[model samples]
Each structure stands twice: as C-alpha cells, then as structure tokens.
Target: MPKRILMDHDGAIDDLLSQLLVLTMPDAELIGVTVTPADCYIEPALESTYKLLQLMGKEEIPLGRGDYYGINAFPSEWRARPEIINALPMLINLPKSPDPYAYPSAPELIIDRLSAAKEKVTVLMTGPCSNLVLALEKAPELKGKIDEIVWMAGAFRTTGNVQTYQHDGSAEWNVFWDPVSSQKLVSYELPLTLIPLDVTNHVPVTKQFLSTLATQIDYKLSNLTGQLWALTLDTIPSYHYTYFMWDILATSYLAMPDYFTTELVKANVSTRPPNAGQTYLDDQGYVVKIATDVNTGYFYDYLLSQFKQ
Candidate 1:
C-alpha cells in the first residue's frame, strides 16, 4: 500500500526536487502539500507549489497557504533581500492579489485530512514547524491520527550551513527562520523523525547529478527541472551552497528508510539570539529521530533510478 504523505515546504531546490520525487513515486499517495517561507517568501512559495502540482497534473492534491510573521512572508523591515527562490524570486514573483492562497490554512488542511484518513499520514517537513505546531496546538485530536513526521530540520553533531549574520551563522536556514515554533513543535513529543544537516549536507547536487537525472526522467519534467534550477542559480549565487539535497534526504527517511541511520535524541532549537535556529542536544526534552549517517552513494543512485521509473 502506498503511504499517504503530506509535504510542507518553504520553497527551495531540494523542496522542489522532493515535490517532484513524490509526484513521481508510485508508493507515495501525496495527500496534500503545504507551503511556508524558507527559500522564497510565502506568496511565491504558494504560487510555485500550485504551478508545479498543475504541471504534474496532480491538482487533486491539496496545497495549503497561510499568513504568519516570516512564515507568511519575510520580515518586511529586514535589510537583506526580501525573499529567495529556486523558482520564485524569478517566476513573476510573489503577487499581492487575493493574498494568493487556498482555504482553511495549512494546519487546518493537514488535520482535516488526517482526521478523515483511514491510515496514518506522514508529513515531510522541508520548512519550519509552524504548520504542524499549529495543528498540534489547535486540534489536539490530530496527534493520534498522524504517523511519524519526517522532517528536514536541525543540525546535530556538525556545523550548520548558515552564513548570514541575521542567523548568527550558528543556525540552519529552516530552523532559524522560525525557531520558537520549531522548539515548541518538538516539545510535543509527537511521533517525529528528523533528517538533520549532519546527514543532508552529504547529499549535494551538481550539474553532473542533474544531467544524469534528466537523462532518466520524463522529458517534460526533466526540462522543467533543469530550467527551474537554471533560473535559481542565475539569480542567487549564494544558493549554490544552500541548494543541496536537504529535503530529499528527509524523504529518504520515509521512502527508503534503510539508507539513512538515525538517532533518537532529546533535542531542541534555540529560539534566542546569536544562536537562534541552531539545534542542540537537550536530554531534558522529548526524543526525536535525528539522522546521523547515510549510505550517500546509494541515496543518489536510488533517486536517479526512481526518477527513471
């Protein structure tokens, strides 16, 4: 039986890759997709998600949107760029029309589906924990309905990939964007698993990997994927580093769990200043699975082959 999965993202290359991978995976019944802001701001993230789902002809899958501080869009007063993009920051950009989104918000949609689902629903989180955190807090019943949440967050036993001063270079991009929510979400001790930076940092993308993947994928999606990355890399030079296989590694924990080794750690995100968004070992908190090592070569090979299928 195919796993019923819900994916919430902040719009990055790996987020897109993970989306396409799910769309293509026969074993994945993608129940819905929820968009937040980590890569692009809220509007573009929502826009590109709807567009991608349309392109794949999977419009039946729900796409959720919301308006939260930073989660809705970048903090307006921040000095740096207002948004980032793997598709957005390029595709006509985030428009202000109708607030550009779908109904009931992400958490509502996710809980609604989980409430109705006959089987456990797994949420692949490629962004902050705002959506799940809200769902958990608002609808206490959802905790029993969900299977484990496979998340692409945090950094354990390794240096995070952040470089910006706003993040204090101590945090990973996703967690730092909304640390308080992340910290709170993990505290619930819901069935959760994390594929943190310690493992994902090894799943890097390059021209060679794309070339190989394109050769194996459907011509149209291959072309679209290539063009998407081209547009992103052209606009953001720094993304070359940020644009690694962060989310896919998280998906691996769901689709091919054996490829990655994880640890159940009592960890939490530091919501405070210079260390905000940085993940730390917290023996005092609930234990969540944190991926520590991976079969890197197998992961890449499997993804390439899966695209071909």
Candidate 2:
C-alpha cells in the first residue's frame, strides 16, 4: 500500500515544491493539506494551494487553513511571495475552484483526518508545528495514529536562517516563528524526523541545477517547479542568504530515504527568550531521528527524475 500522507506547510516556494513532489510521487497518497500563515499571507497561500491542486488535478484532496499567528512573524518581504506566485500566469490562469475550507480550521481538520484514518499517517510538516501541536493537545490519543512526522525545522548543528531581534541566531525560521509550539511538539511521544539546517545548508539551490531543470520542463509539474524556484534567482548572488532546498529535501526523504543519512538524537527546544526556538542536544530531551547528511548529486538526480514526463 502507498503511504498515507497529510502535509502542513507555510506557503514558501520550496513548500509548494514539496507538495508537488508528494502529489507526483508514485508511492504516496496525499490525503490532505493544511496551510499556515507563517511564511505567507493566508489568503494568497490558500488561493495558490487551491490553484496548484487544480493544476495537478488533485483537487479532491481536502484543504485547511491555520489562523494562528506566530510569536515572531516572518519578514513582510518574504511573506509577500505567495501572492506573487499565485499571480503567475500558469496558476492565475487556471479556473478557481470553490473555497476549500474543509474544516473550521487546521487543527480540527488534523484531528478529523487522523481519527478517520484506517492506517498510520505520515505527517509532512514544512513549517511551524502550531496546527499539529494544537491537534495533539486536544486529542492526545491521536498520537497512536501517526507513523512519524517528517519536518523541515531546526538547525541543530549549524547556524540558523533567522537573523532577527532578541534571537541569538541559533534557531531556524520555522522554529523561531513559534518556539513554544516547537517546545510543545518535541514533548510528544510520536516519532519525529527532523530535516534541520544541519543537513539542508549543504544543498543550496544553485544556478547550475536550475539550468538543468530548464532543459527537462517537458511536463506541467516540471514547468511549474522551474517557474517557482526561478523567482529566487536574484537572491542567489547575495552572500547573506540564498534559496536552499529546505522543504523539498524533507519531502524527498519520504520517497528516497536511501539518498540521506540519519541519526538518533536526544533533543529539546528552548521556549525562553535569547534562546527561544533554539533546539539543543540534551540528555533528558526526547529522542528523535535527525537527517544529518545527504548525497547531493543523487538527491538532485532523484528530484529531477520526479518532475520528468
């Protein structure tokens, strides 16, 4: 049987690419998708998500929105991306479907899906853990319904992507968005697989890779993938930040686990200031599987193969 998957994401470019990866992969069935306002304005995020589903012909999948605001919101400039992506000709030209407010909110949808599942569900989280944390808090027993959570969060071994006030630059943006939620999530007994910056930092989106993808845009999904990442090309020359395959890499592990390496680590999140959202190694912390390294050439090859017609 194919893996039953529920995806939760903040509407970043890579997050959308990650969703496309699951939608196209042969070994996975996307049961549902939930969008949070972490890296996007929820309106365009939902609009783009609905449009992407239509573009991929996966419109039957349920959609949910998270209204919860993070403690430290993402930058306004970065948050504007969903609207831009949503307006692209490929997405905006598609006919709009009826609103996909499947449940009252994200947490409720999460509960309803897990409770109704016939087998364990793999929760793919590419953003903050707010919705899942809320659902599990309300229905703690739902823990048994989850197989494992593959999340693109944290920066256990290297520096984080967030360079903001009150932070010591040790936390990834997803965790830094809502440290308390991260704290609550790690406390759960469910298996957590973290694709932290420790590994993703090594896989920045290079111009060479994008040029190669340009040659393989034979399918609609491949074209869409290229267009999405092409938006980040201007930032490539900047030394401060470059687009990394953060969420897509996490999503890739679900289909091609052999291209990556993992380690069991005892970890915990700090909810206090200065170190808030920071994930640290602690003897008393929960044991979680962390992706520590990846075979970049093979991983890129696999990613390119998925989009081939």
Candidate 3:
C-alpha cells in the first residue's frame, strides 16, 4: 500500500512545488493539504492553497487553513517579498470552481484523517508548527497515532536566510514565526525529521530548469511556478533563477530517501524568547534525526522529469 502523507504548507512557490512533487510521486498518497499562517495572512494563504489544488486537479482533497499568525510575535516583511507578492495576486485572480465546500480546521482535519487511516500517517510540515502544535494540544493521544513528522524548518549549522535577525544561526523563519508553538511541539516524544536550510540551500531551482518547465508544461500551475522563479531571479540578481528548494526537498525525502544525506541526532528546540526556534544536536534530550545535506543532481533530475515531454 502507498504511504499516506499530509502537507501543511504556507502557500509559497516552494510549497506549491513540493505539493505537486508529492502528488506525482508513485509511492505516496497525498491525503490532504493544509494552509498554515506563514508566507502571508491566513485568508490569502488559503486562497492560494485552493488555487494550487484546483490547478493540480486535486480539488476533491480537503484544504484547511491554520492559525492567523504566530503567538505574540510581530509579523515580518520577509513573508511578502517580491517572489510571494507576485505569485499570490495571480493565485487569487484564478477562477474558482462553482461548488464550494467547507473543510474542518487544519488541526481537526489532521486528527480526523489520521484517526481513520488504516496504517500510520506521515505529516509533512513545510511551514510554521502552529497547526501541529494546536492538534497535539487538542488531542494529545495523537502522539501515538502519527507515524512521523517531516518538517522543513531551522537553519542547523548554516547561516539563516534572514540575516537581519540578531539571534543565533539556528533561528530560521518557520520557527521564528512561532517559536512558542515550535518549542512545544519539538518536546513531544514522537518520531520527527527536520530538513534544515543547510540541506535545502544546496538544492536550487536553476534558470535552465525553470525555462525547461515553462516550455514543457503550459498549465497555470507551471506558469505560476515559473513566474515565481523569475521574481526570485530579479530579487537576487547574482543568483539568476537559483532559489532554495527547501520545502520540495523535504517532500522528496518521503518518497526517495536515497536522494538525501541525513544524520540521526538528538535535536530539540529552544523556547527562550530571543533564542526561540533554535535547534541543536543534544545528547541528553529527546532524539530525532535531521537531514543535513541533499543530492542536488538527483533533485534536479527528478524535478526535470516532472515537466511534460
């Protein structure tokens, strides 16, 4: 039987790409897609998610929205950079289906689906930990029902993408968005795997790949992804079309572990105010494996194959 996977996305370009990758994988069944409060506000995030699902032809699968924002933390501008700003308006403008249905909250949907699955379910979180944290809080018993959680958060030993923050290198966006929730969730004894920026920074979306995809898949989803890549290129002039494939790498690991290099170390989140969301390899606390590197060649090849011939 195929593995059941749930994705908690923030509706960023990378998140949409990751969802498409997981849906296309032969060995994984994308059970659901949840929109978390990360890249933008919850409403826009949900709108983008709905558009992505419709474009991918997965409209029947439920799309749920997460918390509005991280608890107590001020919102940041990094969420609305040109890459996201350009893509979100396009997604919002996409025509919606005539029949609309209401879905349960992200946390509730997670519990309901996980409870009914015949086998263990893997929750792939590519955004903030707010939904997971809320689910755990409401249903603490879900601790055993879940098989594992693959998260794309933290910076590990690498310099963070957000350099303006004065905190340690380990404090990245996802965690920093809601450190209190992340700190609470990481303390749980459930099996977890964290794919940090250290690994994802190596897997970039190059100009060649984007151009190839644009030429191959003429659908709205591919076009949006391609446009996002162009925006990234414009924002970071020196990098060309190269942008971090952070979330996609995490999803890829679920179907193809051979494409990544991982380390099984005890990892924990620091909850202290200034240092919150900082993850470390500690020997004494609850242990979880974290991916430190990825096979860039394999990623490029697999992503290239996803486009139409």
RMSD of each candidate relative to the true structure? 4.1, 1.5, 3.4
Each prediction's TM-score versus the true structure: 0.85, 0.97, 0.86
Per residue, candidate 3 scores C-alpha lDDT tens digits across 219-309 of 5556666666666554434543246778888888897788778887776777765566777667786677788877787777776665332
Model 1: residues >4 Å from true position, as ranges?
71-99, 232-242
Q: What digit string (tens of lDDT, one per residue) describes model 1 on residues 33-92?
A: 887755656665665676667667776687777555542233332212223432342334
Task: Report, for every candidate in turn, its global Cα lDDT versus the true structure.
Answer: 0.72, 0.88, 0.72
lDDT of 2 by residue, 1-309 (tens): 999999999988888889888988898999999999999888888888888889888888888889899999988878888888988878877887566454459998899999999999999999999999999999999999999999999988888887878878888989989999998898884799999999998898888988899998877667878999899765334676878999999999999888789999999998877888889888999988999999999989988888885
Q: Determine which window of 10 residues in candidate 2 has minimal summed lDDT.
A: 95-104
Residue 120 deviation, candidate 1, in Å?
1.3
Query: After TM-score superposition, what is the CA distance of residue 119 in candidate 3 from its true location, in Å?
Result: 1.5
Q: How close is candidate 3 to the true structure, as a TM-score?
A: 0.86
Q: Specify the highest-lDDT model's number.
A: 2
